[model samples]
Target: MALRTEELMLNMGPQHPSTHGVLRLVVTLDGENIIEVQPDIGYLHSSVEKMMEHRTYFQNVSLTDRGMDYLIALQNEEVYCLAVERLAGIEVPERARYIRVVMNELQRIASHLVWLGTWGIDLGATTVFLWCFREREMIMDLFEQVTGGRLHHAYYRIGGVYADLPEGWAEQCQRFVDYFLPRVDEYDALLTANPIFLARTRGVGVISRRDAIAMGASGPVARASGIALDVRKEEPYEVYDRMQFDVPVQSEGDCFARYRVRLEEMRQSARIIRQALRGLPPGEIRTRVPMTMKAPRGEVYVRTESARGDLGIFLVSDGGETPYRVKIRAPSFSNLYALTEMMKGWKVADVIAILGSIDIVLSDVDR
Candidate 1:
């Protein structure tokens, strides 16, 4: 008889704590090494994509926001505006663009902080997790001031934002950025220098530049691999061209490099927010929208540099009041594709650290 393949199988999640949400992974292991890993998503499926067809332009704003209930309003409204803006061929007002950039960058920083904190907890570094979340709360407070709700603001609409910046918003944003800037270095001193973190992450879950590109990775994952592919830098959407900031790239595409990339990105985001505020002009937040919204009988795609990665909305209109087809190419779904390759030859415990570093949000994966 032929020699045995010597395979062992384990279910890592669907109920595992580190999954971060409803995600399941069927991993095939050769002894202690992972040979194959398949992500079984949609356990939290809400089918938001299919539902977008029924709602009108304004009424559908709330649907897209529902994808990552964690990013709440900023996640949905921002992408939807890009979709609708491309459809209507409208030029958003400068003030609205400024405010949108400010809020969205803040949200990106907050989102990364949550990732940092939670990743630490999964790796047994509990203190960093708590400290990071504490800082993230400060940014969330800023979101509440302008958007009213902390989670889903639905504040961004087509052509412009829902309304002007709330009173003292600029001053408050300036204060937040100033207060937040030093904390980036604080995190560096806390985690970057810690030997335990360095050992666990320095060379683990390594991916090459060619491998990352072939795997369709984006955001920090692709950046860490020295690809330097950032939608913000590449596309320059929503006044990104007007702002000056460097995109951090690491030649080492290991887990540690991914950590450093996001940390550096937060500092850049803070810088962008400050400059946008400096250029903040006085104008209408929302351009005049018609009662019956209709896109031309053509198709267009708009992409944005979301905190996760490249978030794209492909919109198809048949000269109708609502989108005929809307396809959301969620980055997490693509980013998670490399997990099998990354997990091979690693221990089971290291899987959490690896997955968390990729920062795959389940909603983004499922939808």
Candidate 2:
């Protein structure tokens, strides 16, 4: 007798904690090694694009929050508002632009914190999970103080933010930024140097630069794979053109590389926040627009760098109060498509490590 072998098909989720959220992974396994991983998505679909067509442009801002990536709701609002503003030929005040940048950067940091904390839990670093949430709570407090809604803040308006920074809000934001940077180094100390973490992530889930680009990876995912592209740096929406920050890039394209890129990105987000606060301008926070405003009869597409990647909104107006057609180019959807490439040829144990590294929000994927 030479040998006996068989392949097994395993379903990882639809409810499993490691699958992140309502995702099903049909994995083909040859003993402990993975042969193929097919992701089954759409369990969380909200049909947000179709819903946007039935609501007014102003109403759609709140929809974007709950209907898509709820983690970075402000960024979602910013991109949707940008599309409407462009289509309607509205001018956002200078102060509002600066405020958008500040809020957007803070949103980026907060969203990344959620990813890091959950990922830490996935990797069995309970301390990292606790510490990450400790800091994220501070950011959440800041959001609640300013926007009045911690998670789904309808803060960004068609031409500006819903309101100006409340009293002491700027000072508090400065304090958070000052306090948050050192903590990132502490995270580095904990997970970045741990031998177990390194073993699980260092050479695992490797995706090449060419495949990353071919697969349309963006934001930190693409940057981790040596593709140095960012919508803030490339397209320069809102006041990002005025802000000073560096786009972090890594060439290794492994699970560790993805972790390193996101950690550095949190630091850069703080950097951008500090600059925005320092150069905070003064004026009206919003430009007045009619409650039932009708945009021009035309189509416009706008892209913004959300917490995940390139978030885009394609809007068509029939010179009416409601959108004629709305299409959202969600970053999580594109980033999730690259999962198949990342999970191939890894051990069965490496699946969670690779999937968590991508940071996909189920709503964003299914929207």
Candidate 3:
């Protein structure tokens, strides 16, 4: 008699740890091999876009922090402020621009640390989780020193920042940068040469360059697939055009490639921060604006390279204090769209490894 076969349906979760933040994966399995994966999202939706319409431009900064990708809250603030500044024809001061760059890069490194550490836990490499947070805590201290809020710092203002760098903040940041680079190598030593990690990540969860672009994947996900596009390099917002850094790219497009891209990106973020610190200009950190500032009657769209990917905001203003319509092109949402493409054809055991590689934040997805 011929062999008998059947496909099984498994709900991976709106609660499972590997699903990474309230994502539900309706997974189809033929034995241990995955036949199809359909992602069910929106369990964490907060209607933040709608909320922006009722909040003033200034109040929306804080909303962006909690409502979007909270990992890199400063970047979220930067993009939102940039939109409001453009719409209202406000020019940010020179010193403020450099400070934004510095904080933005620092936040990028911090956010990637969170992703790396959590991903390590997902893959059973608990040491990486411990070591990554060890460094991230230092960055958090730096943030707390300046912004007074470690997690949700609404530091970026419409024209610049909420305050100037506190006393010794620059020196402290320099110390952290000097200290953090060597620690990255330690992480490499642990995972880069590990046989088990290599077996699980290498040649797994591969996505082609064409598919990555077609699905609107950005940041490390797209760059890992050999798409050499970064908004910092392409659009040149703030002081990024003047900064010297490399946009790391890999052709493998596998989980290992994603890991390598993010690792190198952390190094590059440090590079940008060093340059921003070295070229720190002297001027006001924030430009004075009315508490109830109203933008002109027009619409503006702004894009910033967030820790996750290409974060964009479209603001429609009717010469009012609050935005008439707000639409956020969250990078996590786009990157998550590519997850289904990445998970198919992999073994059931490789699901967590693959899901962890994309690094999705549900807040960004559901916002």
Candidate 4:
């Protein structure tokens, strides 16, 4: 027995540039190849899920929404309303539905902006980060104009929206989307078309459809891997049933595919918004519910196509004023689970690419 040696062990992150936000990855390496990548999370877990039980049904909406996909605030709350409404059998006005679409799509842009910025930085394109944020700020401005809050608007309420789309809102959103639509080409010019970007991302991480489903992947990661699993289309919640858009798919299942899917989805989101705005029927923004609510004695699973993927909320109400259990099937957490499988055999540089393509938020994972 001349040698009985294992591969070298090296710690990549928890504070490294590539790990992206307080993630400590224990990677076992063999030469330049990654043998195994163990992702260590919970560093940022503030017990948001646990905190939900203490708050009222209405109160918890804001709390839980922040965790589902941190980038898209209030969307989870919208899902929350959908669940409890089903349990209570409440009615939402038509105008509220229109407002939900607007907020949902605007929030999608904001969420995607964060992803684009972080993904660009992760893949060694720092300049795109600034460009992404600049566009995101415009979306934020629109949110503030209507909701009067930037980050966690709590704009969504149990029965409906907190209020109607503010005065002259249509004109504001029209200008923003019009000006913003052309900038997609600028991003394409900046990063996507560059040969270096293509080389780094083109075929970096390939996840097959079967493996992606078996591994419990969702969102762009699964879709990019050739899985046609979109919560919006499969299960129509909100106005997605009437909306006109296509679920972008790619067979490559690589980092480039994920990048392409997100870019294309941005266009789809804009399209959905335009349709929602044009055909936006007028009605009440919210349904009237008391500060505290007692849902019927039943269990409901409400899922929506969040910016990430399937944001499922499994809420069991024991006919109480608050939910007995609120289990969030966050897409980021699900998507992140497949990272280890993809990371193996990839180089250190490729780790960032794979992680970027996976597109996860620590909040979603820890919650």
Give the per-residue lDDT digits (tens) of candidate 1, residues 1-367.
8667788888877988999888898988887778778888888787777788777778778677775445535855787788888778888888888888888899899889989999999888988888898888888788888777677777888788876777887898899899888888888888998998888898999989999899988889989999888887788778888999999999899899999999999999999999999999887777887857888888878888888888888888888888888888888888989776788778776888899999988888887
lDDT of 4 by residue, 253-273 (tens): 989999889988888888888
- Count the clashes in each prediction: 2, 0, 0, 1
Query: Which of candidates 1 and 4 reaches a greater lDDT?
Result: 1
Q: List the pairs of residues colliding in candidate 1.
A: 73-152, 73-153
TM-score of each: 0.96, 0.99, 0.99, 0.96
List residue ranges in candidate 2 displaced over 4 A.
Answer: none
Clash pairs (backbone) in predicted model 3: none
Stretches of model 4 off by over 4 angstroms after superposition = 1-6
Query: What residue runs in model 3 are displaced by over 4 Å at the alpha carbon?
Result: none
- For candidate 4, the C-alpha RMSD (Å) to the true structure equals 1.8
- Candidate 1's displacement at residue 176, Å, is 1.1
Q: What is the lDDT of residue 3 in candidate 4?
A: 52
Q: TM-score of predicted model 1?
A: 0.96
RMSD to the hidden true structure, all candidates: 2.0, 0.9, 0.8, 1.8
lDDT of each: 0.84, 0.92, 0.94, 0.84
Which digits, one per residue and each the tens of the lDDT, describe model 3 over residues 1-367?
A: 9778899999989999877689999999999999999989999999999999999998999999999988989999999999999999999999999999999999999999999999989989999999999999999999999999999998999999999999889999999999999999999999999999999999999999999999999999999999998999999899999999999999999999999999999999999999999999998888899989999999999999998999999999999889999999999998989988998889999989999999899999999
User: Could you give candidate 2's per-residue lDDT for residues 1-367 as a string of tens digits?
Assistant: 9678799999999999987789999999988888898899999999998999999988998999999998999999999999999999999999999998998988899889989999999999999888989998999999998899999998888988888899889999999899999999999999999999999999899999999999988888999999999999998987888878899999999999999999999999999999999999888999998878999999999999999999999999999999999999989888888989898889999999999999999999998
Q: Pairs clashing in candidate 2?
A: none
Error of 3 at 63 (Å): 0.3
